[model samples]
Target chain A: MEQPVVTTKDALLHAAGALFAVHGIEGTSIRAIAKESGANIAAVNYHFGSKENLYLAVIRHVLEKTRCHRSEELLKHRRDWEGKPLLCSEAVYRIVEEYIQQFFTGIHPRWYGRIFMRIFLQPTPILWEIINELVMPNFDSLREVLQCCRPGMGKEEADLWLDSFIGELMHYVFAEDFLLIIPGHRKLSDAGYQKDILRHVAKMLIRGLELPVPVFLQEDIVHA
Target chain B: MEQPVVTTKDALLHAAGALFAVHGIEGTSIRAIAKESGANIAAVNYHFGSKENLYLAVIRHVLEKTRCHRSEELLKHRRDWEGKPLLCSEAVYRIVEEYIQQFFTGIHPRWYGRIFMRIFLQPTPILWEIINELVMPNFDSLREVLQCCRPGMGKEEADLWLDSFIGELMHYVFAEDFLLIIPGHRKLSDAGYQKDILRHVAKMLIRGLELPVPVFLQEDIVHA
Candidate 1:
C-alpha cells in the first residue's frame, strides 16, 4: 500500500479537512488548522493565500485523493475494451462492483468522506464548481455505460436508474453507523462483510435495471 | 393540508431544530434559539430546563413529527391484515411504498430530515437513544414484513436486504440536491416526479429482494 506523502502542505490540508468536516468552513479558523498541523498561521497565508482559498484547496485535495482509484479503474476499463465487442451487462456489473470497492477501500482515515458529506448537507458556493467540474463528468460517464447496457433508454429513465443505483451505494457511505445497529450486522471493515455488500449492491443494480444477468452472477441470484 | 400549530413552545422547538441542524448542538446557543423563536432567553430555561434538554426536545419533536404518519400507516396495515391470509409480497410492497410516501410528505419544512442527517454524519450521545428507542422498533417491524415476504430467510440475510431497501430511499432524502443537478430531472416536490421515484424505488426493492411480483406492480416492471 502506498502511503500518502506528508509535507507541510499535506499536513495543513489534512488538518483543515478534518476541522472543516466537523465545523463548516465559516466555523473553522485558520489558527486552529495551523495549530493542529503544527504549522504557523503565516504558513497558511503563504501557502493558500486566504482562508477561502485554503478551503478550496482542501476540497480539491479530498476529491483528488478519494476519486483517484475509481477514475483509474474507469480508464482501465475503457482502455481494455477499446475496439472490442463490449459485454454491456458485465461492464455495468463491473462498474458497480468497482465503485463499491473503491468506496470502502479508497476512502481512508474516514474524514475524507465526512468532508464531502458536510458539503452535501450544507451547500456552499464552491459546491456548484465541484459539481460542474468534478461530479458531472463522472456521472455522465456512468450514464454512458448504462445507456450502452440498455439500448434506446431515454436520458430521463437512465438518470432515474443511475440515481437509484448510486443512491444505494452512497447510503452505506452516509449511514454506516446507523446500519450497524441491526442484529447480526457485521462491521463494514470486515472483509467478508465487504464482499457481501459488493455482491449485494452490484446484483441489486443489475436486476433493478432489468439487464440480463451475466452467467457469472446467475449463481448468486438464488432467493433467500 | 394541516398546518403545524405554533405555540411559543412549538416556535422554540422549530427555531432550535433548524439551528441545531445547521450548526449542531455545541455550536448553537440558547440565546440564539430564544432570539430566533421571538421568546425571551429565560423562556428556554423555564420550558426545557437547559440547552441540552432543549436539544433533546428538538430531536424528539423532529422524530415524532416525521415518523407519526409512517407509524399510523404501519398500524393500518397490521389492522387491515388481522385474521386474514396476508399476501406477504403485497404487504412488503405496501410497507415500502408507505415508507417512501411518509419520507416525502411527513418530513415537512425540510429541517427535520436535516436534523437527522446532521446527527447521522456527526453522532452524539443522543444517537444511541434515538437508534435503540425509536429506530430499532421501526427497523424490526420492517424486517418482520420482509421475512414474511421471504420465508426461511436468516436474520443476517434479512438485515442485509432491509438495509439495502431503506438505503435506497434514504439516499433520495440525503442527496436531493445532488440528484436535482441532473439534466431534465424534476424537483422531488413535483408530484409527478415524486410518483416516478416512488414507483422506481418500490420496483427496485421488489425485484432486488426477488419477491414474487404482486400482480398490481407487474404493469410497471417492463424494461425501458
Candidate 2:
C-alpha cells in the first residue's frame, strides 16, 4: 500500500497559516514556517518568493475555503421548491451555523480561527483583497435583506441595522473571553447555552430588523 | 516648585499601552515595554506583577477613562435638560461620536485602541469586565430609553433591538478593515460618509424599534 502525500508548498502554506494565525503576521517568520512545513529554507523562497506572500497565500487559501463552504450552504436554501427569496434571517442563520461549526468542529478550525480574527483585527494589503472579493459579497445579500425588510430607509440606516447584526455574529466569535469572565465558558458551550445563543441572536435580528418604530427614540443628535 | 512627577509605574503602563496599540498584544512584550518606559525590571514587576497584568491594567485604566468621560458627557446633557428621550439612533450616534473621539484621542488612547480592536478580533478576560461595568451600564440607560420609546414591544423584541444597535457599533469599530477592503474607509471618515452613516443608522433604529401600536416616525418598518 502507498502512503498519501501533499505538496510541500501546500504543506508550507498550511503550516505558515496556522503559525501566522496564532502569532500574527509580524510575529511569524520564514524559518518558523519552513521548520513546520518540513521544507528547506530555499524552498520557501522558491515557492512563494517571500514570507509575506506566503502569509498572503495562506490567508487567501483559508478565505477561499471559508467562502466556498459558506456559499455552498447559502446556496442550499436558494429555492426550497417555491423560489421565494430566502427569508432574510434564515440566510443569516445559515452563515451563522456554518461559521460556528467551521471554527469549532472542523479539523483545522482553530488554526484558521485565530488567523481569521487577527486578519480582521490587523488587516494587511492581501487580507483586504481577500475580504473584498469573498466576504463582502456575502454581506451584500445581508444588505439587500435589510433594504427589503426596511422600506423607505436610507442607505445609512440600513447599514447601521446590518452593523448590529454583524456585531451579534461577532460576539459569538469573540465570546470565549467574555464567557470565561461571566464564568459561563463551560456552560456557554453546553447544548442549552448554544441553543440560547442561537435563539437569542436570531430573535434579536428578527425583532430589530423586522419590527416597528418607537416613540422614545427622539434625540438632540447634537455633539456632546 | 516641584514638577508633577509621572511615576515610573505610570510611565511604564503608558509606554506599553502605546506600543501595544501599534504592535498588538502578541507583538509587544515585557522587555519592549520596559525599554520604552525607562523603568527597571523590578519596577515593572512591582507595578504590574506580570506583563499580562500590565496589559490588563492598561485596558482597565483606558476603559475607566472612556466610561467616565462618556458618562460625563451624557450626564452633562442630562443635567442641562433632563427627561429628554433620545431616539435610539440619536443615542447611538452620540455614543459613537464620543466613543470614536475618546478612543482615537486621549492620554494612553493607544491602549483603548488596542483593546477596541482586540475585543472584537481577539477578546480577553479584562475586556469583559470593561464591557459589563464600563460599557454595559451605558447600554442599560439606552435600554431604558428604548423602553420609554417603544412602549408596546415585548421583552424579546426590545432585547433584539439592542442586539442590532450593538451590531451598528461593532461595524464602526471593526469597519476600518472592512471599509478599507471595500475602498470605503476614506469615504467613511469623510463628511458625506459620516452624515450618511448617522442618518441611516438613526433612521433604521427609529423604524426598527418602533412599538406595535405605531408612533411618530420618518418611515414605516417592512418585515422580511
Candidate 3:
C-alpha cells in the first residue's frame, strides 16, 4: 500500500496563507514559502506561477470554505423555520445566534482571521473582486431573510440594519482581545457570554427595525 | 533668531508609530527607526532605551491623545444635556453621533488606525498595559451614560449594549475599506452616510433596550 500524499497546490496555499497573514503579501518572500512548504522553488513556480497568483488562490480557498460553512448554517436555519414559520423577533434571534456561534467557534485556521482582517482594514483591487464574487451574493440572501421578517422595512433601512448587526459581530470576532483586556470587567470568555451577546444584539436590531421613526432621524432617513 | 528644533524623542516616536503600523512591533528595528527619524542609533537608545520601551511609549502617547479628545467631546455633551437633560433615546443618539464624527474625522495621525488595528487584533502584554492605563477608564465612563439612559438596565445589560454600540462604530471607522468595495451598494464614502449609520445604530440600540425580553433571553437575564 502506498502512503497518502498532499498535493503541491494545497501545500503552497497553506504555507502562503500562514506567511501572508504574518508578513503580508509585500513582506513575504517566495523563497521562504517554498522552504516552509518543503517544496522547491521550481514546484512553487509550476504550481502558483507567481506570488500574486498564489496570494489570490489562498484568498479564494478561504472564501470558498467560509462560504460553504456559512451557507450551510443559513440554510439549516431556513429549513427549520420553514417547518413552522418563526415570528420576526424569533427569526432575528435565531439568525444572530447562528452568527455568534460561527464567529466564536474558533474553527477557522489560525491565520484566517489575520488574512481577513488585513483585507478588511486595508482593501485593494483584489478585495473588490472577492466581495463581488464571494460576499455580496451571500449578503443578499441574508438580507432577504431579514426583510421577509419585516415586510414594512425599506431596503436601505434594512441594509443599514444588517450592516450594524454584522458589524457588532465582527468586533466580537476580530477584536475580542481589546474587549477581553479590561481588568475586573465581565469577560466574554465567560460561559454563555456569546449567547448573551447574540440575544442582546438581536433584540436591539429587531426592535430598531420595528421602532417608529424618531423625529430627529426623520430628516436623515428621508435623504438616505 | 534661533530656529526651533524637533526633539529626538518626538522624532523617534513618530517614526516608530508609522513603522509599527505597517510592519508591527516585532518586525520593526531600531535601525529603521533611526534612519527614518534622522536620529542616530545612540539617540534612539538614549531617549527610549529599548525598542519595546519605545513601542509602549508610542501607545501611551496615542492613548492619551485619544482620551483627551474623546473626554472633551463627552464633557461637552454632558454639559448640554444638563441644561436640558436629554431623553434616553435622544442621549443615545447624540453620543453615537459624536462617536461617528470622531471616527470619520481623519484628524488622527495617518498610522493611528493601522497601529490600533494591529494591537487590537493581535494582543501582547503591552496591550494589557495599554488597556488598563488608558482604555478601561474611558469605557467605564461611557458605560455610566448608557446606564443612566435606561434606569432599569442592569450593569451586565448596559455593558452588552455599549459593546454593541462601539462595535458598530469600529466597523465604520476601521472597516470602511471593506464597506466601500461592494459593487452597486451604497458606500460609506457617500455624503451624510455616516450620519445615517449613526442614526440607524442609535435607533436600533435604543429600541433594543426598550423592547420586551424575548423568551430565550429571559433565563439568561435572570442568571445575569
Strongest candidate by DockQ: 1
Instruction: State the DockQ of every prediction.
Output: 0.50, 0.28, 0.35
Q: Rank the candidates by TM-score, best first.
A: 1, 3, 2
Model 2 whole-model lDDT (C-alpha atoms) = 0.58
**Model 1 per-residue lDDT tens digits across residues B104-217:** 764477667677787567556566777577667777777766665666777776777877877777777777666666666666676666666767777777777676566666
- The list of candidate 3 runs beyond 4 A from truth reads A1-54, A68-86, A144-156, A184-191, A211-224, B1-57, B68-86, B150-156, B184-191, B211-224
User: What are the per-model numbers of colliding residue pairs?
Assistant: 0, 15, 0
Docking class of 3: acceptable
Question: What TM-score do all the candidates reach, one by one?
Answer: 0.85, 0.63, 0.71
lDDT, candidate 1, A57-163, per-residue tens: 87777776656234335545664643333355566667777766666764466576677777667655566787667667777777766665666777766777878
Deviation in angstroms for A23 in model 3? 5.9
Candidate 3 colliding pairs: none
Best by TM-score: 1
Candidate 3 residue lDDT tens string, B1-224: 11233888888898999898776676687899999999998877799888888988888777776562343355456645533333545666666766665555555665665666776756777568777777777777777777665666666766787788778777776676666665445665454565567656766666665633223222211100
Global fold similarity of model 2 (TM-score): 0.63
Provide i-RMS per model in Å: 2.5, 5.7, 5.8
